[model samples]
Target: MPTSDAVLDPAVAARLTRDAAGLVAAVVQQHDTGEVLMLGWMDDEALRRTLTEGRVTFWSRSRQEYWRKGDTSGHAQFVRSVALDCDGDALLVRVEQVGAACHTGDRTCFEAGDLGAVVGAGA
Candidate 1:
């Protein structure tokens, strides 16, 4: 049997604890590098799309719509694997990031120059 999202039952989605906006936390990470790319939220449909479409999709809270990473920016993230946190309230998605993952064109959304400088200074 081919293991595809189409055939994979989504019954687990109902067990997730969503935020007040009906979104579950989704953390995107690079599969090989283990670099955290970005954090997004997903509703049931968004989760379904991400699994079935093979792309990291998120539900935009402000826009109230579904946005697939790299759709317009050409920085698509292909899902390699998905894992549910122990609490079942969060999702970690390992992906193959193509191009910049951040909307600002940075490799990652997290930029802590001060933290890096502080850590390096002590070393």
Candidate 2:
């Protein structure tokens, strides 16, 4: 569960109050390995489920369903820590991953090579 200090932060609380969408982006990462696993979205229930279950669960925007990160793929993620960005509209979930995090069987979703060298040194 998030500390009271985090959940009670005025900035965080403010962003949590979405317009009519009831959604927020969640960026998932591996805690120990420092690898990005995946990105998903969350609603109030999804947030509660992740905190309560200590697992990485997301609300599927396309399917309109709740997805438990390794439920079918056998790549479950155990929560280690969670943070809200300064704007409080997004979340960073640090987790302990069990297996391949990406559905495509890649270690990370961000597998593209750096193009900074070609993009004027840094884009």
Candidate 3:
């Protein structure tokens, strides 16, 4: 759901901060559960395709291709809503995910990482 205040157009793309490789960070979240599934890179075309196609599409930095989530695997992510951060450097994509968002076959990419090591056990 795009709001009138946030337009997904060429102007918006121009305002965003992309790296030298012309990519911005996109964080994908589970719509209902509010679970952050994964982070992917997105170029302007990928962002446009995500809005227009009604599915989450990403610029694969490793493969150097456009990968629509669940395109190759059955675990697809349908766009429930999208929000651009105030800085225009990142996007929060709330999706109705169909299956695992991780390549490792886990429900989410963050599950494998040890949060305790970074955040500390007591803190």
Worst 10 residues of 2 by lDDT: 1-10
Tens digits of per-residue lDDT for model 1, 36-118: 99899987778877888899888887887788999899999999998889887899999999999888889988963445443
lDDT by candidate, in order shown: 0.84, 0.78, 0.87
Model 2, 41-70: lDDT tens per residue? 887667767876899878887887888999
* Model 3 stretches astray by more than 4 angstroms: 1-8, 117-123
Clashing residue pairs found in predicted model 1 = none
Reference-based lDDT, residue 4, model 1: 29
Model 1 error, position 95 (Å): 0.3
For each candidate in turn, the TM-score is 0.83, 0.77, 0.85
Off by over 4 Å in 1: 1-10, 115-123
- Which model scores highest in TM-score? 3
| Residue pairs in collision within model 2 | none
5-121 in candidate 3: lDDT tens per residue?
Answer: 433587777778888888889999999999999999988888888988899989888888888999889999999987888888899999998989999999999888675655657
